[model samples]
Target: MRRKYNPYALPPWLKKSRDVLHQFAIPFCIFQGIRTILFPTAFDVLFLIALVLITVALKIELL
Candidate 1:
């Protein structure tokens, strides 16, 4: 029989905060994206960028 590989097993922290991000960040990004589209502005652009960067940092366990 073959065994399945697990990335989270290699590093326990890899799956850390997985639920939190899914429950909050993902949905927030969708709403924020819509708001930025309807009312485009410099602050909205910066906020979107910040959100994306923060999501990436959290995904890589940097923050």
Candidate 2:
């Protein structure tokens, strides 16, 4: 008989960081949407940069 592996199981630190990023990303995305509606030009570039940085940071944590 062969054993199976579980992918959902993660280390404590990784789990915690993953949780934190998930939480942060949600609100940031909401605000970004609001910003897009409220003031599209003022922080257009800034918000794009912030989102990219957040994405890259999360990608590193995923690895």
Against the reference, the lDDT scores of all candidates come to 0.74, 0.69
The backbone clash count of each candidate, in order, is: 0, 0
Candidate 1 deviant stretches above 4 angstroms: 1-22
Tell me how far the alpha carbon of residue 3 in candidate 1 is from the true structure, in angstroms, after superposition: 36
What is candidate 2's local distance difference test score? 0.69
Model 2 weakest 10-residue run by lDDT? 54-63
- With candidate 2 superimposed using the best TM-score fit, by how many Å does residue 1's alpha carbon deviate from the native? 22
My TM-score estimates for the predictions, one after another, are 0.60, 0.44
lDDT of 2 by residue, 1-63 (tens): 985644367688877877788668757867786777778886775786677677666666542
Q: Candidate 2, TM-score vs. the true structure?
A: 0.44
* Least well predicted 10-residue stretch by lDDT in candidate 1: 6-15
